[model samples]
Target: MTRQLRTGFLLALQFFSVIPVKKQLPMEKEYITAMYAILPLLGLLFGSVLTSTVWLLRDTTEISSLLLGFIVVLIGLVLTGGLHMDGLADTGDAYFSYQDRDKRLAIMGDPRIGAFGAMALVVAIVGKIILVAESINEASLVWVLLIPVFSRIGLLALFSFTKSAKPDGVAAFFQKRVSHKKLQLVAIVALVISFMLLIWSATFLSAIVLIILLFGFSWLYRAWCLRNFSGVTGDLLGAYVEGVEILLWMSLLFFV
Candidate 1:
């Protein structure tokens, strides 16, 4: 494939729910840079789809809030194909089992979900359902849009600061593919856009608080990883995404 076509393909694979581009693109710098660009765009795409779904359900029929929330969940699952869900499951299985660092890393790489993963998945989904039900608003939904984008942006911090505990897998691909300078640039852009979105949504203060909290959590995550596993993994990135999204909603719901 031409470089441009390959780059676009990589972005599509990394970012969008539509057009499932199956083959993994070459782990090039351009491909990795495209990932940061593509990642936030997925948030925008999902948010737009979500807003439309809510409007359609609200307008076309008398959908109950509970049912609507379920639909929203399904839409998210379909969009990302449960990518983050898998992350949550893996992280939970690894973290909560009280396994040693090497064992935890090994378990995280396992495809099978354990009892801890199952429970964590249930809790995370239920929490999302409740939050979506309560926070369903045109404005709030717009802020809800921030969850995926910022979560992926937050992934960059993990990639930037920590070593990959595993020598192989998705984490290795990203670490090899993306450079520090490119990751930093993408993060700055994502954060600036995030702040602007917050301002636009009239939640500027909440946005600031959220960023600080994200950094704080990132530090804690890093420390925990070092103490236990000695470095971060793909599952940890997934956990970070879900945890941060939950915290963001909880903060916005109660504090903002």
Candidate 2:
């Protein structure tokens, strides 16, 4: 169990971020797929990175909370190497171009940023900064800390449950390589963790609210994927993560 966990953790670090793993670590695709279980933990790590900035600077007279919050979000971007954000950009450009589905996929494959992509990037970045700051100011550190954790779980759920649009790219590789049993177990674990976090931070009612909304959103996103690109892609997954992360923050402000 220890060795399996270590292997999964190492693979999680390799896949989710640009962090350098130990030279002794193996890069097994099976481990990479199994590593989905660790995404929530990886998110906890990320949440710590962003929240530590607030905790460290909260007592400072010169550093404004707003600035600290922005710094935290910026640090998050750096931590992840902006990989998901890039996907979000590409997804926005591709999905909103109103072209044929094939052309849209082709657009996402391109390195260039379109107008829609630029707009989506601005919204996501700004929304993250603002909502993060608000949550901090609200002293909702628990929610902030768990937001990434839940978002990662959300990402894993999307990857596991949805069909790959074109059976191409990294998303396809993950879908194909991950075994069903492992995927189901990991997703269930993540869902259980999500419920625990929500219940810990808020009332059971609030937790139930979130649970219901996520199911609804998941169905909607799946439908959108079917209509737009025939199925989900890495970019769409990233977009879902960002969208859900911010929505989770906002939802807690009212529901929690």
Off by over 4 Å in 2: 22-29, 59-63
Over all chains combined, what TM-score does candidate 2 have? 0.90
RMSD to native, candidate 1 = 2.8
* Colliding pairs, model 2: none
RMSD of each: 2.8, 2.2
Off by over 4 Å in 1: 1-19, 22-24, 58-62
What's the TM-score of every candidate structure?
Answer: 0.87, 0.90
User: lDDT tens string, model 1, 70-147?
Assistant: 788778778877777888899889988898888888899899999999999999989987776665643365575777
Task: Tell me the whole-model lDDT of each prediction, alpha carbons only.
Answer: 0.74, 0.79
| Predicted structure 1: lDDT | 0.74
User: What does the lDDT read for residue 196 in candidate 2?
Assistant: 85
Worst 10 residues of 1 by lDDT: 9-18
Highest TM-score: give the candidate number: 2
